[model samples]
Target: MSHADPDQLTLVALGEPAADRSTSDHVRGCAACRAELASLREVVALGRESHVELDLPMPSEAVWDRITAEVDRKNTTVVAVPPHRPRRRVRGLLAVAAAAAVIGAASAVVVDRAATSTPVAAEQLLARAQLSRLGTAPGGARGTVRVVRTGDHAVMRVAVDGMPAPQGLYQVWLYDGVDTMIPLGVLTGGEVEVPVPAKVDLTRFKVVDVSAQRLGQQEHGVSVLRGELG
Candidate 1:
């Protein structure tokens, strides 16, 4: 069966009734459509609790340089490169790489200080999706992921639950669901936020993937969880 239109699903998520009776009927009967609606509903709920936007100064150029260098050292690789293909999104995807670099820095420093520190910006979600358990996943594993813009910067927020411990680490990625993927970062907890390059067009990378990987692994590993962004 054809899937529900994503825009209509978004409308339904925003408290608009489905335009067609069949869409409401279809959501009740189709598992994927149901799941997608549930995910969007969560997005709505999160939006209620999300940060209020604020205008703030970008840190110094030296600060960005160091951050950029840190992001460059991650275990990233290009699994496939099409020499002949035209990619308008190449710049944005690479910026996603730059955004992925700040997961470690942001998650640690921001938690305790947000309350007393002068407010900079609050989270405004740009996009989100539901991560489902793939065949490779254990029965208990599942997750939610979102892209948020705060002031001039953006980050990918990932939260997982019911996953068993892995021997090495769990890593996240923005995948095209085809020949290429960019490592977002290692999953540090049940929830982690990784910086996103301002340039990424979220539509170009439709899939959010999580995999169990060894410490030195540069290649994407056995899939444990995956989902598509709507």
Candidate 2:
């Protein structure tokens, strides 16, 4: 009936099996959703490409041991890597090969400024907000927001936990807590990077709100979480 769920489309694109069977069927029949899926796949491809185009040598085993120890530590959430099992390949190999051509007694490095640029300097954190659960939100709902300046643009990097899947999609917004509410973008899953509206003044629309909205529904729906920007 309605277009495939955005979150499910992202999961499918990321090599994780679909959570709902209807989403797959809808994607097969709906050209719009299929195109959206393709676009998400491109983003994932670019992330993998960035990792691939690194001109560096593999780190020693001891170096990897240190990384593992950090991951084992508590109270740390690793956002750099996607949680999907199959996508681990991309996260596992970062600057560990791909763009490097090793030779005897010398390391030949070839950095593609074009390919690896997105994941480097473009990711600059501007602000952060710790989202608080709303009255309508689930009991264990929690979210984190990071306003990251990506190259010329700024985006809201939102990550949530214990959030139930919405009937349609979850959308991020900058609410002024009065009249104006600017829609950023559709949130694909537990985490998404939504492009903030251009020329937005955070002083006005300083509240980051995540809402569960139905397909093609105008105006806001049930509020899941909200956080004030600092």
Candidate 3:
């Protein structure tokens, strides 16, 4: 794998690392690198303000103001790349943003539907779906995996039922079509979120599986549950 550029490094510093080789090595080595990555992540997160103007078909004067506000909030400016080339890039960004919004909203719908149902519990459904490491006693426990789509980029939340509390800690993984599972990082707790690789075709892994594990090797073990998205 090739090393990431400065921008990729900046994203990694902000808790959003591109799938580059160097950043992973740095993450394994330096504490300062991790702290810097978190700070950048929080800064990018602050730009997630919901401006009603962005909802309009054509950007209104108000929309431009909100856009500027977002850029200013991040201490960055929107670069106007060559119009022809940028069209594809801009469209891709919009698609991912739209997908993320849809996924986030769907989570609420799932909860509402569960509230009306009798069998499945919301926490259990969420855990099985989103949480990577899950273990349960010998009953029919439930869990939910909420994956939001932003273009091809996916973000997911996991909730589990009957899962034994972590002995120490565990991390999440995104399995490729092959046997290898890439580390997304340590779970934040019962509720944690992470960005899925833009390259991962969700359709291929519709029935993605989650497992509970001790953080020794990057192997999938004792999978607790699995579900299909499409």
Top-lDDT structure, candidate number:
1
In terms of TM-score, how similar is model 2 to the real structure?
Answer: 0.49
Better of 1 and 2 by TM-score: 2
Clashes in predicted model 1: 1
- Return the clash pairs for model 1, or none: 99-195
lDDT of 2: 0.69
What is the TM-score of each predicted model, taking all chains together? 0.48, 0.49, 0.36
Model 1 TM-score?
A: 0.48
lDDT of 3 by residue, 1-230 (tens): 33223344443433433555766786667676566556545434433433322321333343344334433444754422222322223323333333344555667779999898777323312222433333443355455667765443557776656555665454555554467666565554555677766776666655555566775755665556555554
Q: Which pairs clash in model 2?
A: none
The lDDT values for all models are 0.69, 0.69, 0.50
Model 1 misses residue 220 by how many Å?
0.7
lDDT of 2 at 38: 86
- lDDT of each residue in 1-230, candidate 2, tens digit only: 56765545644665657766887888888999888778666555654453334333445564355345433434555323223322233333333222221221122133545455665554787788999999988899999998978778888889999998888999898999998888888888699987876789877888999999999988987788999987
lDDT of 3 at 49: 38
Better structure of 1 and 2 per lDDT:
1
User: lDDT tens string, model 1, 1-230?
Assistant: 78776645655765656868988988889999898778766544543332522122343444345335535533544222222222222222223333442444466567757766887688798889899998877888889999888888888999999888888999999888779888888997788999876566678887999999998999999888899988
